[model samples]
Structure formats: C-alpha cells, structure tokens
Target: MKKIETFCPVRDILSQFGDKWSVLVLILLEDRQVLRFSELAKAIPDVSQKMLTVTLRSLESYHLVARKVYPEVPPRVEYSLTELGQSLLRPMHSLIDWALDHKDECLK
Candidate 1:
C-alpha cells in the first residue's frame, strides 16, 4: 500500500464529484447540451433556487462550467459544460458506473 504522505489531491478534488447536487448538475448538462436556469430548476425539482444558484456559481468559479448570457429584454442565460468539464466526465462516469454496480455492497 502507498504510504500516506501528505494531503492527497485525489481526496481534495473528489469533494465536488461526491456532492450530489454537483453530480446531478453535471449529468444534466451532459445529457442536455445546454439548459436555461429555469429548465435546470424544473429538471431538479427538489433543489431550491438559492441552492442551484450557489451550485452553478461554484462550478463557474472552477471553470468546469460555462454560463452564457444573451442581450434581450427578458435576459436569457444558459449553462453548459466546458471542455475541461467534458474531459472530467470520462473518469466521473467510470466512478459512477462502479458505484452503481456495487451499490448493494456499498449499502451494506
């Protein structure tokens, strides 16, 4: 086994992937090329507007997600995964698949 040297970056970075809301948001974005704020809210019925906003802002800060705004009287905004975020999907999906396959074992 590898020695526990210092703070492992894997654990540090896994926080976002482990977050339910974050994972859901990323999955939704991947399924839906782009989504408006209201659309995302409707997609995730249980999440509060405040929480969704906070989650999007956090993802935006990490540069893993992109937010685009349109100049219109009504003001339209859309969200999509950035290239880096798309790259992350591969590894994330692998972990997700593993979790799903071992769900029963994990729950025990």
Candidate 2:
C-alpha cells in the first residue's frame, strides 16, 4: 500500500482522546458512572490535580464529559459522561481490550 500525503482532520478529534490522561479519565468515568473531583484524584494518583482539571475541562469542551456542581459551602462537583460520550464507549472498550490482549507483545 502506498502512503498518501494528506492532512486528515480526524487527527484533531483523535488528538483529544489520544493522550494517556484523557483515555484514563474517560475509562474511569465510564466505569464509575459518576465521580467527584476528589474521588477522581484518589483514583488516579499518578496524575496531578492540575492535569486532571485540564483534562476534565478539555473533555467538557468536547461535550464528552458532563460536570455538575452542587450549591454548597464547600461545593460538590461530579463528573460523568454525556450521551455523546456514552456512544463512544463501545469502540473505546474495544480498543482497550485490543491493547490488553496485545500488552505482552507491545511491552517488549
């Protein structure tokens, strides 16, 4: 097969979810259903709070994640996937499963 030299716009969308943090956050949100900021922080200790905040904001901008805040003194914030985001789960899980199955070979 010959490689075509062309710019693909799909790269823009993929770029958003291609990062490790984005993938992790999406996976976590999908599995947990809904999670608070602190809960997410606890779940992903490797990621800095700032980075997670950025990731959540990015997802929100893309309409893939929905964030809700409750009116309270301390403020209660929760994150979950939007309907559009939910639609992406099947393919995302498939990709995840593929990676897991190929982990040993890829790790080498």
TM-scores, one per candidate: 0.88, 0.88
What TM-score does structure 2 among the candidates reach?
Answer: 0.88
Residue range 35-80, candidate 1, lDDT tens digits = 9999999999999999899889888887789999999989999999
Tell me the lDDT of candidate 1.
0.90
Query: Which candidate leads the pack in lDDT?
Result: 2
Residue 60 accuracy (lDDT) in model 1: 85
Q: Across residues 1-108, which tens digit of lDDT does each residue of candidate 2 receive?
A: 534434355678888877898888889998999999999999999999999999999899999999999999899999999998898889988998999999999999
Error of 2 at 61 (Å): 0.5
Question: What are the root-mean-square deviations of the candidates from the true structure over C-alphas?
Answer: 1.7, 2.1
Weakest lDDT window of 10 consecutive positions for candidate 1: 3-12
The 0-to-1 C-alpha lDDT of every candidate, in the order given, reads 0.90, 0.90
How far in Å is the alpha carbon of 17 misplaced in model 2?
1.5
User: Which stretch of 10 consecutive residues in model 2 shows the poorest summed lDDT?
Assistant: 1-10
